[model samples]
Target: MKQVIIIGAGPAGLTAAHELLSRAKDMFAVTILEESAEIGGISRTVRWHGNRMDIGGHRFFSKEDRVNRWWAQRMPPQGAPAYDDKALGRECSLTAGGPDPEKEDRVMLTRRRVSRIYYNRRFFDYPITMKPQTFRNLGLAATAKAGCSYLASCAHKLPETNLENFYINRFGRTLYGMFFEGYTEKLWGRHPRDISADWGSQRVKGLSVSAVLKDMLKKAAGKKQEADETSLIEQFQYPKFGPGQLWEEAAKEIENMGGVIRKNCSVKKVHTEQGRVTSVTVQTESGTEELRGDYFLSSMPLKDLVCGMNDVPSSVAEIAAGLPYRDFVTVGLLVKKLNLKNETKIRTLSGLVPDCWIYIQDTGVRLGRLQIFNNWSPYMVAKPADTVWIGLEYFCTEGDSFWNMTDRQCTDFATQELLRMGILTSASDVLDTHRERVKKAYPAYFDTYAQIDQLTAYLDQFENLFCIGRNGQHRYNNMDHSMMTAFLAADNLLAGKNDKAAIWNVNTEKTYQEEKNESGEGGAI
Candidate 1:
């Protein structure tokens, strides 16, 4: 039997294990080692006051249909409450009502709806919509200034180099400063001009400032573009219980296929010999133990993974350890009452939350993104009138002052900020709050990141050892993109004749391709 040891039981690791087991049923022995006591990595959903909530926000908006098909095969049956819309895309009927009596263990559902981004201390249509909100904020003067500056900058020329220049080229310096720069700086903890433009170009490439402006103009003039049924924003699918349900289901399936998942077991050292991974030394509840493997897949932070390797040159290890990460502090608040007056479902409420996730550009406010959980799923709360769950995501790094604060202190700080913004009136209105701190949540790309080429070069030494996922590849990946990377990695490994380096570059062409499909704009209801 061919044995494979997969490290980190995240979507990537779990998917790889599943594919391997299903393809070579009787010939593979798979073991997934997860450091946390749970199966899902960052996508894990937690419960407070008998309701499920995501640490941050997790949505199902992949452009790939195969990924959708893979999920559909594992999801619960029709009566299980799935949300599918022709206009919006995909939906799951997971509710707070309770689990399915037949497949209670396999299925978890929630009725929470989704919310949009909040900006400038006011609500605007996210994805940059044309509405009363935009006009009110920009006014005639600022709007004119923005238009003139944008055209002038476009005429002047951009170097095609850094993020600041990229945004200035597209949206102009004035709008970039007001809307884009500060929020991005806060998330990455660096000045926008210093960060490479590739980050924004890759993530926000499909979105053009010209498109937004044109769409706004058309809508303002009482005109609408021909609708394309196949845009990402038109609709999306989500797990009923939260995004974590998908992974938990995958974990159960992996175990059922004679695979073992060892949770709460942290790998202390990855032992390698003769330029190959030999065994891993893990610390469990009892003590440390060594396990051997034929092939290894890691989804942990690349820096951390390289550091954990037992036999690496000190210079190489130092270079790996030097890579930085941006951490996150999520404060989940249980509100005593349903706050929104519209009461419309969250999917249609994209601009409803004012912004799906508010960007705390004003440093005076400590919260980076304020996400309304109930909007994502009504089932996030056990009782509709009982309490509503809201997540305030604060971006910080490990050992930072905010990170060092206790959960209670962090919650207090979040609540205080809400009060300061006049969003929350009294502590009494907040029934309870919980804080979750994720270390090395996102990899930071510095101006001098190219200097750390040694780490990638060292990782390249192992042919069978694949590093993937968001943290795995140190790239900003959406759920679908992350899953795609994992899928591509497995496809390459299973084929036994492909280059892993090339597989990491999957979505580069995704931008232009998507633009061709979505050419027009739509009017608001």
Candidate 2:
């Protein structure tokens, strides 16, 4: 049997390990080396005083039926116990005969997709829906100006070279300034004009004013909605605890199938012989060890992966070294209540705004987004009925001032921002707080990103090396997108196919991960 070594136990790495074992266990023996002691990389669930925090919110909504089936196989969906959501008017999907969430611990629950943009002290529908309240929120004069700007943009288009032009072309300069400009700056720590348009195209390719209009007309005409548009997804499946639950379960299944997972192991060097990867040197709690493998699947940061290699072309190495990444920090806070009221008819355990997450478009603070853990899954919180569990996400560079701050300092700063925004009535409302920082959370699309194709071509020369996941490909991929990359990679290795085009092309199309082979396997050929 050929030994396979996979780096980083994130979605991509875990999925690749699981796929190889489940597909051809006798042909491949897998060993996963993770740098951290957690199962799911950024998708991990951080528990403090009983409440759990999903580092970055993951909504299990995919257009691929195979991916949905994979998730359902792991955590079967069931009917809601006490959260009678239909009273709120939002439609949801709940299946029966899976597992009763009230009695069973490992079950999936359907959650409503309620997200709003908090700007100017008023909540606007995310993606700027064309509704009376939206127009009223923006005064008549501003609304008219926005309409005129959109018309002018449609009449004359600018070359989409940078992210600024991409947003303006799709959303008009008026809406881009009010919505996209500041948030983009806050997210990447750079002006939108300085970033590449590739990020915008992949992220919001299907979202536009015309698209929103089409959705509104379809809804008004009582037509079926398409599943490809993720922004319009009304409901999604979530594990009982958090996203980490699914990954942990996958890891267990892998072990049960004779796969090995080693935590607290860091890959320090990628040993290459001629044009192929032969082994990897890792640093562990015990000591250093060299792991020789027939195949290597890496989900680590591409910059670090390339840097750790022995021999690489100067231009390729230079581009890899200059790759930029944005770090993330989530401050979990358990509070008594929020100052915002339940303006919608949605009934909650307490009178709270029914938002799984809120985008901080005000840009007056460093806060990037707010996540209500209770809204994601009631099981995420220790007391979903009495207390509110929230997460404040901030984007920054590693070792920066904000990232360098102590946990106490960071929590204090985050609490002050909530108080400044009037989300908290007093400091006494905060019951507890915890902070977690993640490095290389988001692969940026600037700096030497333009020459990434050359870097990938050089790396592709290694016949035994396969790159997967967001950090591996240096792309902004969602959870399902990362998993699909591994699926394609596993399919290639098992079928003795050496070309990586299908794996790399997983999310290039408008509809991500929808194309499947004739065999109904989730891959693009």
Candidate 3:
């Protein structure tokens, strides 16, 4: 039997391990190395004081039936309405004879995708819908300016050379400045002009003001819009506890199939013979061990993976060392309630704002986005009926001033921002708090990223070494896209299809890359 070594116990690696074992368990020996003690990577759920926090909001809505089916088989959809739906007397689509979420923990619940933008202490439709209330909120002058600016943009399109122009061509300079400018800078820590237009093409594919207006016209004419459009997607699936539950279940299944999962084991080095990978050196608490593998699948950061290789060209090594990444910090706040009101007609528990998350577009505060944990899953909060659990998200570089602040100092800084935004009245409103930081949470699109094609070409020479995942390819892929890469690699390997192009080509089609998502919808990957 050939030995298969998979690095990084993330969704991509776990999916690869499961697919391989399920297909030909006796033909391959599978071993998974995870750097963290947790099951999921950034997709993991953090627990604090009996409450669970999803690092980033993950909505299990995908255009791919294979991805949806994979999720359903592991955590069956709920046959009965969930707690919030039952309490609110709300209706939801359910699967027949599926597990009951109220009685079982291993069930998936149907959830509405309710996300909005908070700018200037006002709430607006995330995609900037055309409505009287929206215009009223923007004020008559700004509305007219925005309309004229959009017309000017439609007349003379700017060359899509950078991320700023990419957004300007779609949303117009007026609305782009009002919406994308400051918040984007806050997220990437760099102006959009410095970032590549590929970031726009990869994230908000085909989502433009025109698309939103067209969808509005269809809805006004009594036609139900398709879920494929970013603005019109209304429903998605989520595990009963959190996304981590599904990954944890996947990890267990991998172990039950005679696969080995080593946690707290970080792969520090990859040994290559000629152009093929021979073994990897992993570091653990006790000591270091070297394991040989016939095939190597790495889901680690491309920068780390390439830098740790035995030998590499100077130019290739320079590009790998110069790869940029954006770190993330999520501060979980258990508050009694927020000052924001539920003005919308959508009914929610405790008459709370129905938004699952609000993109913080106001540049006054450093917060990039905020998540309401109660709306995610009733089971996530310890006391959902009374307390509102929220997560304040900030993007920064590792070891930066913001990232280097102590947890207490960070929590206080976040609390003050809430007060400044009128989301809270005082620091005492915060019942409890927890802080988490993740390195290389987002693979950035600047610096040496322009020469990535050259790097990939060099790495592809290693026939037995396959890169699979967001960080593996440094393409900022969504969760489904990441899993698809692994699935294709595993299937091709089983069929003795050795060419690596198909594996590398997993979400690279120009049309698909520019039209499917708007940067993963500001949700979990």
Candidate 4:
């Protein structure tokens, strides 16, 4: 039997294990080595005093039917059809312990999405809704400026070279300066001009100022707007408890299938010989041990993986080292009460709006975003009536001053920032606070991103070495995209051939198969 060693217990690695074991359980021995004690990497959920907090907000939505089906098979959707007790040859009723369908469907929950942008002490529709209230807040002067700038942009288009140019070309200079510039600079810690247009193309594709304006006009006229595209879906499925529940369930299933998962095993070295990965050396509390495997899959950061390899070309190492990542810090503040004081009136925070999260676009504050855990799911809070948990997200570079701050210092900083932004009246309103720092939360897509192509070419030479997942591939992919790559990788392993090109193209637009017209023309209908 062939032995497979998978590194990192994130979604991608776990998905690969589940797929491989399901198909070739008798022919392959699969073992997963995770550096952390937990299974989910960034998608993990943290429980504090019976409340759950997602490391980063993850919405389980994908345009791929296969991806959705894969999740459904493992964790069926709520209210999906199930075998009745009579059909299962059971005499007792469901209430009498005869197979309760609701109990069986415990993994996923359907949720509606509500997110808005909080800027200049006012809230705006996240996708830029135009309402009388929005115009009133902006005043006639700013509104005219935005409208004129958009008209000018439509008449005279600018060349889209970088992120800055992309936003200006689509939203015009005035709106871009007001909405996109500050928050983006805060998140990336660099001017938008330095960032590549690829990031903008991938994130905000199909969205344009004209489209938003049309939707707003329709809303103002009391006419129904067009349905949102897949990229702008307003509803999604989520794992109960947290995203961690999904991976934890997968880990249990893997163990049941005789696959091994080693937690707290840090990979120290990847041993390669004869242009193939022979084994991996991992360190644990006991000591170091080398495990031989017929195949290897890595979900660790590309830079660390290349550095830990036994022998690599200097050029590859240099490219890996040059890859940059943005670190993340989330300060979860537990509050006893929240009050919103606006010019019109002072009111309790409840019943104002149901927003899962709010982007902070105000230039006066350093906070990039705020997540309302309660809005995500009531279960996210220990006692929804008594306390609310809000996550203040900040982006920075590793080893930076903010990243190096102590937990107490960071929490205090968040509290003050909240007060400064008028989200909190006083620090005394906070009941408790916890802080978590995640390194390499985002892979940088700057002008230097072309170096990743070279790195990928070098890594592809190793027939048995497969790099999958976000940080593993050094791409800013969504969770579903990460799983898709893993699925393709498992297919390659099952076929006993390396198809690096296929794996690399898994999430790109070019990989999507367009529908055929009646005349057999291959184009999207």
Candidates' RMSD to native: 5.6, 4.9, 3.4, 7.6
**Model 3 over residues 89-193: C-alpha lDDT tens digits?**
321212122333444778887777777889889998877899898999999999999999999999999999999999999999999999998888888878999
TM-scores of all models? 0.85, 0.94, 0.95, 0.88
CA lDDT of 176 in candidate 1? 78
Worst 10 residues of 4 by lDDT: 516-525
Instruction: Let me know the TM-score candidate 3 reaches against the reference structure.
Output: 0.95
Runs of candidate 4 with Cα error greater than 4 angstroms are 79-105, 213-228, 341-352, 510-525
For model 2, how does the per-residue alpha-carbon lDDT over 133-161 read when each residue is reduced to its tens digit?
89999999999999999998899999999
Angstrom error of the Cα, residue 187, model 2: value is 0.5
Error at 73, model 1, angstroms:
1.1
Clashes of each: 35, 0, 7, 0
Supply candidate 2's per-residue lDDT for 435: 97
Better of 3 and 4 by lDDT: 3
C-alpha lDDT of all candidate models, in order: 0.67, 0.84, 0.84, 0.76
